[model samples]
Target: MRVVMFGYQTWGHRTLQALLDSEHDVVLVVTHPRSEHAYEKIWSDSVADLATEHGIPVLIRNRPDDDELLQHLKDADPDIIVANNWRTWIPPHIFNLPRHGTLNIHDSLLPKYAGFSPLIWALINNEPEVGVTAHLMDDELDAGDIVLQQAIPVSPTDTATDLFHRTVDLITPVTTGALALIAAGHTQFTRQDRTQATFFHKRSAEDIRINWDWPAHDLERLIRAQSHPYPAAYTFHKGNRLEILAATVSQNRYGGTPGRIFYRENDGIVIVTGHDARTGNNHGLALTRVRTHTGQELPATEYFTTMGGYLTRRP
Candidate 1:
């Protein structure tokens, strides 16, 4: 089948690579233009690079509403259009261009983490299982008919980066399998249950700040969710920002104050919880790895010593 592929970021990159490896013919690839601003430095290779390497025509557009994009879509005349992590909401006309209709590969199971940063939100919210779904693209974001879905286990130690890689691995196989089924006309698509749907917003820097007052389990989830690749959950230590990369729930129940650095152990730093004795659980959180304001990543032991044990708070 002739295909028009739309994607961005690493997820998009993986999808494009899969299509190249598959039996289907990718006629054109569409990707967002590279952004080189102070806040957008995380941007990586353009999907066009892969398409160009494969000798396929490539189109770069910031938004799907562009008139040029509409013209390009008409010119491509693809049999199927597959969108993977395409940031923009595609216009209806583009979705209606192909005969088989456009298929979208969403990171989370449909009707769940629909909007953006699904993987991050899943870990932050302590979801036990994460999955990918291939669905028919609709006007509503990720509110489409499901073509295929597969689940992946999320370990207690898994970070957003870890889940991201796992999800990608899960998605590639399911996506390729779905495409092959579609090409063979052997699959039936089911509409999503709108009542079961939930969407998450794009995670911002403000969301990365660690809230010490939250329950130890919740804080632990957040720490793992944002660890490495994604920014680590941060807290203020002696007016300096400390990024907590890894942490474990402390088995000990000694607690006077939340966010209080009780003591430093060889394994990590044990901090007390600030919950009221009558109502809140007095569990401590152990800090394993942390990043200092100097942009240095160090173990909690090294960090506490380097700061001259300044994290202690007045009782």
Candidate 2:
């Protein structure tokens, strides 16, 4: 089958590589230009570079709405289009262009986590598993009919970075398998249950700010979700940003206001957590490691020499 791929970053890079290695011919490639956005900078293997190296026609577009790009797609005349991490909404005219239509590779199970930063959101929400889905594109964003879906169990100690690696490795096999099925004229794809669907926004600095009102267990998961290279989950202490690098739920319950620097537990500092913390029945959040705004990383034990202050959401 002749193919056109719309992809960006490492996800797109891997998808393109899969197409290049498959029995299909990747005739044209469309990808987004380099971005300075925080999340876009990570997992960024260049899709454009790989296409050029292989001598495939490449087009760079922030979106696929322009006439020149439309004309180019018509000229390439591909049997199908494969997209991964494309970063923008692809229109019907283009997605519906090919005979078999466009196949999108998303990094999470469909009907849930349908939007950006899916792995991070899933981990923070304590989902038991995480994986990729290959679906046929429709008018709605990521609301397509499922072609192939695969998942992996999310470990208790897994971080967003860990899940990224695990799920990414599945893209190749999923992409190839879906294409082979389509090439063989398989049309009985699964329809997504919109009632069970969820969508999330892209992560920003504001999203990582720690809210002590949350239970310690949830806070701990948030810390892991925003693991290294994706910015740390943070709070304010003494008018400075304190990024929590490692944390756990305390074994004992504590009393007083949420975010209070209460007592030392094991090898970490225990911060009172949960909106109902004043009841003294809620578990506290134990900060094992932290980073100061100045970039100095330290054990929470060394950093909070004397307790009894508050970790605020704002300075």
Candidate 3:
């Protein structure tokens, strides 16, 4: 089969590599230019570079809505289009161009997380498993018929970064396997249950801010969700931004206002948390490691020499 790929970052890079390795002919590639967005910078393997290395035709577009791009797609005359980690919405004409149509590979299970930063959102919400989905593209974004899905169990200690490496490894196999199925004239695709679907927005600095009013378990998961290589979950300490690198739910309960720097247990500093913390039945967040505004990382014990103040949502 002749293929055209639309992708960006490592996710796209891997999928393109799979196509290059397969029996399929990769005729053209479309990808986004380099980005400075916080999340966009991570997991960024260059799709354009890989395509160029293989001598395949490459087009860089922030969007696929332009006339020249549309003409190029018609010229390429591919049997199918494969997309992964594509940043913008693709118009119907573009997605519906090829005979087999567009196959989109997403990083989460469909009918649940259908949009951006899915692994991070799933971790913060404590989903039991996370995986990848390859589905036929339709008019709606990520709301299409499913072709293939592969999932991995989410361990209690898993971070977003951890799950990222695991799920990304699925793209190659999922992309190739889905293409093989399509080439064999398999058309019985699974329809997504829109009633069970969820969509997410891009992550920003505001999304990583730590809120002490949340339960300690949830806050702990938030720290893990935005763990290193991505932005660390953060709070304000003494008018400075303090990023939490590692944390856990405290072993003991304490009674105080949310955000209070209350106690030291083992190697961590316990920050009182939860709306009901004052009732003395709630566990606090035990921050184990942190980074100061100066970029110096430290153990939470050393950072809080005297624990009597507060970690605030704002300065």
Cα deviation at 278, candidate 1, in Å, is: 6.1
List TM-scores for all candidates, in order.
Answer: 0.90, 0.99, 0.99
lDDT tens digits by residue: candidate 1, 1-315: 989999987778888888988888898899888765322334354687888988998888778888887788788889999998888788888997899889999999778889888888888788889999999887888987898999898887888878777888875788788888888896577889999888987787778787666777888888888766666778878888878888887776654556667766558787765455234356667788988889998888877764223232221
Worst 10 residues of 1 by lDDT: 306-315
Question: In candidate 1, how many Å is residue 128 off?
Answer: 1.5
Given candidate 3, what's the lDDT at residue 83? Answer: 98
Give the TM-score comparing model 2 with the true structure, all chains together.
0.99
Clashes of each: 3, 0, 0
| lDDT, candidate 2, 1-315, per-residue tens | 999999999999999999999999999999999999999999999999999999999999998999999999999999999999988899999999999999999999998999899999999999999999999999999999999999999999999999999999999999999999999989999999999999999999999999999999999999999998888999999999999999999999999999999999999899999999989999999999999999999999999999998999998
Name the candidate, 1 or 3, with the larger TM-score value: 3
> Any idea what lDDT model 1 has?
0.79
Model 1 scores a TM of 0.90
List clashing residue pairs in candidate 2. Answer: none
What lDDT does model 3 reach? 0.95
Local distance difference test values of all predictions, in order:
0.79, 0.96, 0.95
Ranking by lDDT: 2, 3, 1
The alpha-carbon deviation from the true structure for residue 23 of candidate 2, after best TM-score superposition, in angstroms, is 0.7
